[model samples]
Target chain A: MTLQIAGGLLIIAATTLIGWDFSARGARRVRDLTELKKSLILLKSQIDYSIYTLPQAFSHISPRVAAPFDEFYAKLAKDVEGGADAASAWVSAVHSLKNSNLDKTDLENFAILGMSLGAMDSGVQINSIDMVITNIDDSLKRLLAENPKNSRMYRGLGIVAGLLITIVLI
Target chain B: MDITVVFQIAAVGILVAVLNQVLKGAGRDDQATMTTLAGLIVVLFWIISYVSDLFGTVQSLFQL
Candidate 1:
């Protein structure tokens, strides 16, 4: 009887954790998007004010952003300094990101932003950054609208699912 | 037969009803329907052996 109870508890705990994890993803994505926007805005200011080359600008801004992105920018700076072109360096840095909260669409948008980074004039580069910022804004709005309902539903679902599994097993 | 099976089925029905409401409230009507269907299937799986046993008894009584 004790063994059965322990097993049931284990099952409940696992399923509940899974549900919580799934729901938490939306909020994490929101944080990641916000950070990306902040970093890009900083990049824009770097471009507008300083005459630093792309690598120098990235290295300077890398420390200012949050983790994952700080590492992302730092890697981009290193790659650019290592003689990789801006576009490829950006793509590689983006691809190298591990366990990032940003989803596929966000990553794809960032990759597209890379294509215009160093290949174009400063005016075009700033415009591209502006475009990405706008995209992040739209995504943030949608996520904020959807997150509450999703979080509640998933949390409830998780607990109820755990209970159901426990009942079935017991 | 264990009476606990009936209680388990009732518990499942309640949980599934709550889950269905949650999914529907979240604007996931398709998922709500799917959850209801899945719950029904799970209950059926639990009771299927008893259902077969009942049929067997009836067949033996009727000598059919």
Candidate 2:
């Protein structure tokens, strides 16, 4: 009986943890979107006010923002320093991302922004950044709206499925 | 030895399918997919030992 209980508990714990992770994913994603929006806006202001170049702006902002995006920006700065253009540098840094909460669509939005920045005039670059921020906002709002319900469902599903297994196995 | 495990698994299957449908209808396709996958894993874990026992019995009977 102890063996049965322990085995059952182990299974429940593992699967429940996964469920909990799924529940938290939406919130993490939304948070990352908002952070990305803020960073882009800051970069825009840096361009407008400080007259910083792409690499310089990236270096200035990279240390100030949060990780794992801070790491991304810093890597982009380093790439630019190494002679790669802003767009390719951004793409490489994006691909190297390890623990990103941003999904494909979010990545796509950022990628589009990167392609439009650096070579353009300040006015056009700021416009592109603003567009990406708006896209991120829409995504953030949608994810936030769905978060509570999704989290609860995943949590309950994990526990219930675990219990059902325990009943059958024991 | 009894057929109870089969019935239990069938019941779980039915319940999981219902839950999946409900969640999907509520416009949560990701959650629904996870719920179904979780159900499958739980059922498989529950039945693995029984499946192994059945295999042992079969091997003994065939003397293989």
Best by lDDT: 1
Task: Report the C-alpha lDDT of model 1 over A1-106, residue by residue, as the tens digit.
Answer: 9998998889889888988998998999999999999999999999988867999999999999998999999999999999999999998888976479998889
First chain TM-score in every candidate?
A: 0.94, 0.92
Q: What level of docking quality does candidate 2 show?
A: incorrect
Q: Point out where model 1 deviates above 4 Å.
A: none
Residue A41, candidate 2: alpha-carbon lDDT: 82
Error of 2 at A124 (Å): 1.5
In candidate 1, which residue pairs get closer than 3 Å at backbone N, Cα or C atoms, i.e. clash? none
lDDT value, residue A24 of candidate 2: 89
Candidate 2 local lDDT, residue A108: 74
Candidate 2 on A2-115: residue-level lDDT in tens? 898899999889878888988888888877877788889889989999999989999999987887879888998899999998877888887776469888878877888778
Best by DockQ: 1
